[model samples]
Target: MTLHRLILREIRHRKVNFALSVLGAAVAVAAVLSTVGALRAYDRETEAVIDEMEEATKAEMAKLEDEIRKSMKGLGFNLFIFPEGQDLSEVYAEGFASRTMPEEYVTKLAESGVVTVNHLLPSLTKKLEWPEQKRTVILIGVRGEVPIAHRSPKAPLIDPVEPGHLVMGYELHRSLGLKKGDTVTFMEREFTIDDTYEARGSKDDITLWMNLGECQEMLDMKGEINAIQALECNCATVDRLGEIRAELGEILPNTQIIETQSTALARAEARNQAAATSRAQIEAKEEQRARLRAEREKLAGWLLPVATLVSMIWIGLLAFINVRERLPEIGILRAIGVKGRTILGAFLGRAVLAGVVGGVIGVVVAKVVKLPSVDSGPIIESGEWIAAIVTAPLLAALAAWLPSLAAAQRDPAEVLRHD
Candidate 1:
């Protein structure tokens, strides 16, 4: 009889053992393929979520920037000019003395015809003592709208201040034991508080604001202003700022013109940096997740190879026992002129057939079974299935090699004598 027919007959007769061997190999393949599928799927999903969040964050930032740009309408032309002797950095020093500039400079700027001057607001500041309150007060004088006022949740738009009225900073109002309609004595003159503003979260928060004429009279510095904040008719741009600076240089050589864009850019850069930090944090989280998945997959990856080794061992053990039980049959076949190679092929062929069967079942189980750890359904790739199917039989063949050789080399004379 042919070796193929012989292997089929042997498998049919020992169906239970063959099925067990196939089942063992199938379980191993299923485990490996399933874990691989789940890990790949999870990685894809995590990247997708990260990408979506990044896009959403960018959109939100753009919307905020657009809103800020829109709200800044008709308000981007501020040019702060300070006297030459008083540097900008000196204003931040604890005991720095400030020098005032001539009030006639405002007239010179308007008269220079360099640019259209919309509003020329001159300001003065002085460090004063409120002896009754036992506190140092920052007294500010403004000829036009308050430069530091901004709309916030706690503070809304302020009404234009009348000449005699005083507006206290939000924190300053809280610190001073005074309120609207309360009388306060400064420089031997009594003045009533007209309004208390909300906290601006800056130096202005602790400052007191009043009319330019009142401050000039109180400080005894008439016709002398420390700084001038002007709103020009044209847009605030690099070119326009340069033109303004050149014009100011020609007219008021002792003053420095400061454009407001630097401060705006600083604020914008801070926000963008914050957004980038958040995005980095999110990406870090995703990367950590991916690393964990890889670790888990690495751990899980060992299971199938170990199972395959066990399956190979099991097949080897079965083949060995079969050879022992069928020694007389092998002896009879050899006696009847069957070649040793054919006998070896018969045993190895059986092992391969069992492996193929097991691999098929393993692929099916991996594709169907749902894992608790994996959120998505069973994921079995075609390549993984093919690898499992191909590797199983090869492993079985390798396992059966020694046993099959032993069977084929058995002396027919000794076996038939025992039979």
Candidate 2:
């Protein structure tokens, strides 16, 4: 019979040994694949979070840029000066509440002949307690021209507020559930709502407007204003705006002159924060991946090797025992002129077949097993499967080496004499 037929007959008779070798290989492969799967899942989750942070930041920055740019047109290059420690993003979005400058600054700014401007509006802002809503509302006081309310053509413009009357923003009016002719108490005094003004998709829509003098009296800030908004001359360009900023710097050394380019600065700040968030996410994920890598290395370097080594020992012992049990058969084959190489090939072929079978079972176990603790399921790589398949047979051949050699070298004369 051919060596292939001989190997098949041997495997059929040693079914128990074949099954044991395959089971051992399967267990080792499953362990390694499970560790790898968890690490890949973590990597996927980290990427998702980083993508989300970037997307949200882009949307927010785009909206801010559009709103700020739209509000700047026909409004001239307005300069807003705020307190040094204040964040411009928050100030520009929601008007400043704390007094940043004295009322005398406005008078000095207007009187400065070196800096010629069309108009300057010195404004005071405070958060007034709303007992009904259990929150506070933004109250802005404009001393000079009310540019925003007047320029907005769609606004329901009101005549000058006579002391005890209030001009509310349309949004604020809707939020407070108030109407014209309604009385609201503020600073222990009640005032009649004169009308609601429209500012069209600006923060001004959420504010309450009053004359600067009346606001000061109500807030007890007699000679204090928080901000100064200046409308540049009609013929002014970007260079002229810079000249105006220089003049303001010489006049108000402690105050910062912020032009419309604050929008650009805001955009830059948003991008920087978005990049920082992405970096943080990547770093955090890398830390997690590092930990997983360490664990996988431990399994690969120690646990997997130990399991494989045990499998090799068990298979070698079984092969040696099989050689002893079939000594007479091997002797008879030798007497019939079978070469030692053919006998060795027959034994090694049986081992290789067992290895292949075991490798397949291991791959199946790796894929089918469920790990409840790991939220992301196992990832089975084709490379790993190929490696297991290719390596298992080689490992089996090595294990059966000594047994096959002993079987090949057995004395046929001594075996026949004993029989």
Using TM-score as the measure, the top candidate is: 1
**Candidate 1 lDDT, tens digit per residue, 330-372?**
9999999998998899899988998899889988888887777
Q: What's model 2's lDDT at 73?
A: 30
Distance from true location, Cα of 90 in model 1, Å: 20
Worst 10 residues of 1 by lDDT: 148-157
128-238 per-residue lDDT for model 2 (tens digits): 775655656788776544433223232211234567778787787887788898988766678899887665666566767777889988788887788877655433246
- Model-by-model lDDT, in order? 0.72, 0.70
Model 1, CA-based lDDT: 0.72
State the lDDT at 307 in candidate 2: 76
TM-scores vs. true structure, each candidate: 0.56, 0.55
